[model samples]
Target: MANTPQSKKRARQNERRFQINKARRSRIRTFLRRVEEAIASGDKSAAGDALKAAQPELMRGVSKGVFHKNTASRKISRLASRVNALG
Candidate 1:
């Protein structure tokens, strides 16, 4: 459907970006799952550690444009509260 050469090139670039962003999103979800698992297991220390690991990954997702900044911040805030409440 991309008749123009420029359009074809853009389609290719968009596909590549889609793959990259998909991978990044999956990675961030994995980190979040770890935190959730730790929390569910009722291990405060482990949950805190997992949250520490996930926070930067989430922020990186924001920096990479895979996630919105406020979305990442809200997630971190909620997770931090859950971890703290475990104390």
Candidate 2:
């Protein structure tokens, strides 16, 4: 229960932020999934393209504070390696 006006305002802001972050997280997941699917399909070129597309989205997630920089970097590294292996 937010008794004070400031607390109420904060609660509203929190809800708004939660929704926004949720959407961003979902979008990131969608990009990751696309890369994974492309990889699984055994098309190196498609996977590479998908990885290229996902890279910026992952970094955007980091920039927006949805994901840690290291985490994004690690994911990108792993995905790149997998894509390379597909060759």
Candidate 3:
């Protein structure tokens, strides 16, 4: 329904941003999954490594507005605890 030229351009921009944000979200999920898998396998070292890798991605998601800051912090806290409990 974007009949006006400006609206049509904005619609296109929205679509592009949606695709980019979706990809970033998916990438963040992949990092989280890696940490989960490492924890599930009871590999403390691997879990720690995965957590280290994922920490930045989760924070990046917060910075990019894909996730809330406290949500990311909570996730990192839970994952760190699980990692610590492994050893």
Candidate 4:
């Protein structure tokens, strides 16, 4: 209901943050999907390249508070291993 002015302002801010976070999450997912597709296609080089491109985006998500640091680290570690295995 946000009867208080401060509450109303907070509600607005929350909505804005929600939208921004949602977009960031979607972008990160897109990068991850690219890596997955490259890996699935059995193109080791392409998968490696995609993983390289995605690494920063994943870390950015962590830095921006969109993802946990360990979660991002784990994802990067797992993806890197898979890419290496493609050799």
Candidate 5:
């Protein structure tokens, strides 16, 4: 329905951005799932390693506008707390 050339270009750009963001979000979720699984398995070292790896991916999601800043912060905080509690 994009009649104007500019609108068509914008639609294309939006679609591209959507795919990229979707992939980024899925990647972030995968990293978070790894951490959750490690935590659930009660392995402190594995959980720590997973958290370390996931932290950057989550932060990257925030930086890339895939996630909100506070949302990422909250997730990191909660995961860190859970990891710390696995004493």
Candidate 6:
């Protein structure tokens, strides 16, 4: 439990940030899933388009600290490769 007032405030802030980050994470997942589905469907153009849309969202997640830069870059690299392979 948070005993001090400052601790309580910090706990509150943590909870708020957690909720915001959760939502952001979920949104990013949705974008990624779109790319996955497009890839799975074997549509090169669609997958490429989905990747284009997802790139910024992924980078935004990185910028906001939801994902590490290398992690985001790895994801983009793998997805781009898969998309390219579909051609």
The C-alpha RMSD of each candidate to the native structure, in angstroms, is 0.5, 0.5, 0.8, 0.5, 0.6, 0.4
- Tens-place lDDT per residue, model 5, 8-45, is 99999999999999999999999999999999999999
Tell me model 6's lDDT, rounded to 2 decimals.
0.97
lDDT (10s digit) by residue, model 6, range 1-87:
999999999999999999999999999999999999999999999999999999999999999999999999999999999999997
lDDT of 3 by residue, 1-87 (tens): 999999999999999999999999999999999999999999999999999999999999999999999999999999999999997
TM-score for each candidate, following the candidate numbering: 0.98, 0.98, 0.95, 0.98, 0.97, 0.98
Q: Report the alpha-carbon TM-score of model 6 versus the true structure.
A: 0.98
lDDT of 1 by residue, 22-53 (tens): 99999999999999999999999999999999
Residue-level lDDT for 34 in candidate 1: 98
Q: List candidate 6 segments past 4 Å from native.
A: none
Clashing pairs in 1: none
* Per-residue error (Å), model 5, residue 27: 0.5
lDDT of 2 by residue, 11-51 (tens): 99999999999999999999999999999999999999999
lDDT (10s digit) by residue, model 4, range 22-66:
999999999999999999999999999999999999999999999
Q: What is residue 76's positional error in candidate 1, in angstroms?
A: 0.3
Q: Which residue pairs of candidate 6 clash?
A: none
